[model samples]
Target: MKKALPATHTSMMRYAVLSISLIITTGPAVSSALPLMAKNFPNISLAMIDMIATVQQFTIMIFLLISGSIAKKIGIKPTISIGLIITGVAGIFPVFSQSFVAIFISRLLLGVGIGLFNSLAITVIDLLFTGNDKAQMLGNRSAMEQLGVCILNLVVGLLLLINWHMAFLIYALAFPIMIFFWRYVPEPRVNKESKETHQKINMPVVWLALLLFFLVMCSTAIIVQIPNIIVRGSLGSATTASLIISLNTLAGMAMGFLFGRIYKVVSDMTLPIGTFLMAMGAILIGMGGNLYIVSLGTILCGFSYPLAGTYAFNLLSKIAPQGSETLGNSVLLIGCNLGSFISPIGVRILAKISGNAFIGMFIVLLVVTGGILVFQWASKHVSKMKKV
Candidate 1:
């Protein structure tokens, strides 16, 4: 029996849906424990140890390709439940296993778990809500993901003080979230025959995916230079890096709450606003002479991230072909993940031209972003003129 698709789901049900976002970024919560992990495994190279933190991204991309297909077979709720289970089991797997390979494999599964549900997280919002409420929920979802990053990172930090193994316990939090989702959220009634007809990729999704790819590629490259700027300028200590990053996450969380209102006012122009702010953020960090300036820049970057990211998801909700929602989102997720992966190389390549790591990347991004902002504003102006 299928539950009726209502215009609105209950508040608790919405939160149950939102709870899953809390674990999306938890893959990196253990990053702070890397030094301790290195001490535990003397034979492992520092670079490999670092992979324990980032190896998730690679596997995320792999699982993203098939995430939709699995959801199709098992249904969304069960698919998400399985992903959460994988995350919980894999997350704590390191606590018991001493072998580096085993821990590394666990990290890989963490990515798999997140990848499986990443698209469905937003798909659920699309199905359960309508119009402004939908937009607001999407924003809340973004906020929730950042909130998870902020809280779990802190929890992991505190846990690290007791035992390096304790850091993995943070992933155990997923089981409760899984239980909440299973209990409160109803399985969306989907038309398998109709949805199955259009499994092929659509052009709109590809274009949006490209837009997100370029956006993330430039933004990530610019953000990556901030720590280097801090270190090179000798404006702050190593701890300052963590503080600035935290502020960045907090800024994104703040934006997620306000995004729905802001979107009502700006509509599609949110992309331009986001890109413009991102460019400004890079400029401030690259050129600013001190710590406070860099902090402001980092905050700007954070604020802009959810603005662009949520907007991408929102647009996809409306434009994604009915049956292939997860696949469309998977493409967008892959774009951003790829952007993060390529950012370092992009920064290194750009830095050579200007002889300053941050500035070189900032210059290109500023021009590109500025040009697009102008084009977008002009197009809107012309459209208004036509209406008048």
Candidate 2:
């Protein structure tokens, strides 16, 4: 019938899963608090305002290529632990300050911390687990991260209704959990040569990473744009828009719980299925004329996001060289940040030209889905090769 996955698989996986989840929760807390942040710090320009998303991505993109090397030289545990400490401290700094310079410094430090964490976290999953275990581990990892973002965003939104500074406090909440993870999570096993050489970047991996970059760009655009689009487009009131966004979060949390279990049954169908659903969801959100339609689309969008995200990571792990765990994970961070970095500007420019964010987002989603399909084909063909 079926073989069993290892106990270490379940246990060690939790450490990365939990830490990444915390990291996601922290950043989105800022996003959810944007209006309040702007009110408190009025000098925040549209260009500087956009930096809320862009700075983090810019830092992650710049550091991702180097993080793999750092993880190899230092060790994943130390890298991640140090990142958490820095991230926690930087994240907490903004809660007390209204100075734009101080706030910007905090955001910059937060970005660096995330860069470190993102680089090591996914790669550690590749190192700690293998085969079917790897697939499931990645799925579970994606779920935890997605769930954290969705849930924490909701919490931040709720807390923002109370006070903006309260939302920043949420970043501190992660530190205790990370401390526990540091104590419990075992160090990864890397060979001396793998650590020394830093393995050549595979051409196929780079190609696939570019494809993932496009996919994530569309996803981040939707995630950031949906609430405002709904409110401004007259599809719903602010409260209704927030609730719809929260439903999207719930969908992600549900998908995270089910992703690995579903993968066991669907196998290779997962990525294609997820991409298709996600594309359909994005289109639904774009074309939707009312809140009901938008809400339905969001639920579908949520399900599709983490499913595809997890599949992307699983594919990266499969193709990555031995001891290239950090590198593989770095690719994911790079792809995701590249997507985030481009989305707001693209959406803003498109909105300026087209006169509607919905239409712009719709066009972008179609292009993104097309990219994912191309990568899906490439990855399948790559899977067929005896050597990557």
Candidate 3:
């Protein structure tokens, strides 16, 4: 006979799931509104208009470097609450002002808020669950994040039709999530003694983070290059490109939702498997002449992104010392953000060297994938030898 869990426990899980979705709300906050914003601010250069998105990403990177330390000092709950409040408040600033500088400031603040809680989502999940449950929750978190991106983008797109400023209102969703978090999510107890006893980060974890960096960099290249690739090839219009990208997002979300089951089947091999898929995707995109093949490549790349991310974070949680999940997540986030920031540059450099951008990107993906496979095999052999 099995004992049933209490209602309170179930309710808390529901609230936690809802609260975690806020972590991804910022993903499409300004992205969907960019065109309308450009029209509204006709005086600003297109590059500067693009800065409205880039500035937030830069802030997110900077804050990600420090968010773990902030959590340690202030406590995760307080840090998350503050982040939610800042995100909610600052995200709406564009509603009040049309000035480029004012909107930039708002986006920067939103980034700060996002950075504060971005890594913390995994940390909190690590605290609340364990073993298979933890894996399941992490998968669900990834799914919810992708779903949030889809929903917010759709909502913002609709709102942009009314007015760009209306899109900012989506950020206000953070307040309720903050309240849910504060009320339902238990604060993890800190052990002052564990601080002194913390172990150095595992070498394997560092290697995994590096691998993730390359993977993210490669995956992001698809997003950056697809528009130009399609336009230049005469394969599709901008709207078609957008639709393909949305399908890619949807594929990732579907994989995320199925991740728990997938993990059971793939287990530790998830990393290599995901890397292989990403490489294949990149190759398809680079070589495919038709729109269908390119769309398929985008979907595979999208699917692999979340699959790899979920497994990597799960591995990090396993390797991290007691009371150091936050720090581990911070390291992972740094790698992810750095990968994204450098992706465009990396592509351009490779394109220049190879004389063909698509081919260059394909080479990069193939090399990275080969490296990851070798690393995985070596690590497994080493482990087996240690057991002997």
Candidate 4:
């Protein structure tokens, strides 16, 4: 007759810890692998190159609905465990890959893994916490993700100096994350009536979710492409690009910590302010030539992410039935994938018109800024309505 551990206890700790590992295991490796992957799979058409980045997001987007359902039906722990195993297996692929197809397929599998983990992790958090506790957990998850980017990107950059293959070694870090789930993380309590009572996702929530997805896509676009754009545009080498990217990570890490501190005072309005900061960052990155300006943009954008994510999570909690954050994550992952999928084509279009990829990236930033503002408005209006 042992009582269940409170959601505030085990579940929150589990998500915060896993969130760090998820980002560490995935984010930097993807960034580090890009240049090396291009070299290894030469003759990869731009279209195909775009697919490599986009495929993961696409798979996550497609599989998320199913993954969410599966998590509800089976268990969050199993879904998370399966995702880690898939990502781990996919990680070992680079060692064997010499062809475009091998790399391409591997990235898709990685997406499947990401989709599972992303969907389940959010759901687990949603199930475990309520009210402000939920908000803080989401905030911490955001911080952990930024931490992952900071630590992994820096490590990958240093490792890249050794050999590009060494970059893939980052995946090995995830092996321990699986063990962590088994040891400390307990199964998220499932709501028995949720399946029977939950309506089809509300229409308003769907629209907001889609818009949120687009914002995430924009963020991912910046994260995946910005470093290469800088290296190619101004810095002129992978090593230098790594330094610039590391600065971006440092900025994000600092902002993540700041958000963890300020989340209370900033409260819900953090979304608009965050979007404003992100817009400023994008403008600086797009328009400025001074490396310092670019660094400033990176920090501003980094801070914006957690702010936006926390705001979105709060909005989502209101719209979704019980355990909606998992669904919310699926939406977010899809947006990220769509952004990755769209970037190459967008670049192609920009390249044709402007004759340079960096300028194209700048243009993309402008477009993303417009989209971010639109969502900020929508989210705020939605929040006001909820209050009324």
Each prediction's Cα lDDT score? 0.83, 0.71, 0.78, 0.64
lDDT of 2: 0.71
lDDT tens per residue, model 4, 126-218: 777667666766666666676776667667778778776667566666667777665667777666676555434666566666556545554
Q: Write one digit per residue (lDDT tens) for candidate 3, span 1-388.
A: 9787753357675556446664554544567678878998899898888877667777777777688788877888898888888888988888888688878888889889888888888877777677767777788788888778877777787888888889888888888888888877777655787545544466766877787787778777888788887888899899999899888878888888788888988888777678778877887887868999999989999898888888999888667766667777877888887888798887888779987665676676667667767877898999999999
Between candidates 3 and 4, name the one with more favorable TM-score. Answer: 3
User: 1 or 4: which has the higher TM-score?
Assistant: 1
Write the candidate numbers in order of decreasing lDDT: 1, 3, 2, 4
TM-score of each: 0.91, 0.83, 0.91, 0.76
Which window of ten consecutive residues has the lowest lDDT sum in model 4? 20-29
TM-score of 2: 0.83
Q: Which residue pairs does candidate 2 place in steric collision?
A: 123-325
What are the per-residue Cα lDDT tens digits for candidate 1 across 1-388?
9876443467789889999999997776798889999999999999999998889998889888888788777888999999899989998998888899989989998999988888888878877777878888999999998999888988998999898889999999899999999999988767757456656568878877877887787666655666777777898876787678778888899999999999999987887688778777877887778899889988998898788878888888667766777788889989888988888886777668787655765676577667767866887999999999
TM-score of 4: 0.76
Best by lDDT: 1
- TM-score between candidate 1 and the true structure: 0.91
**Reference-based lDDT, residue 254, model 3:** 89
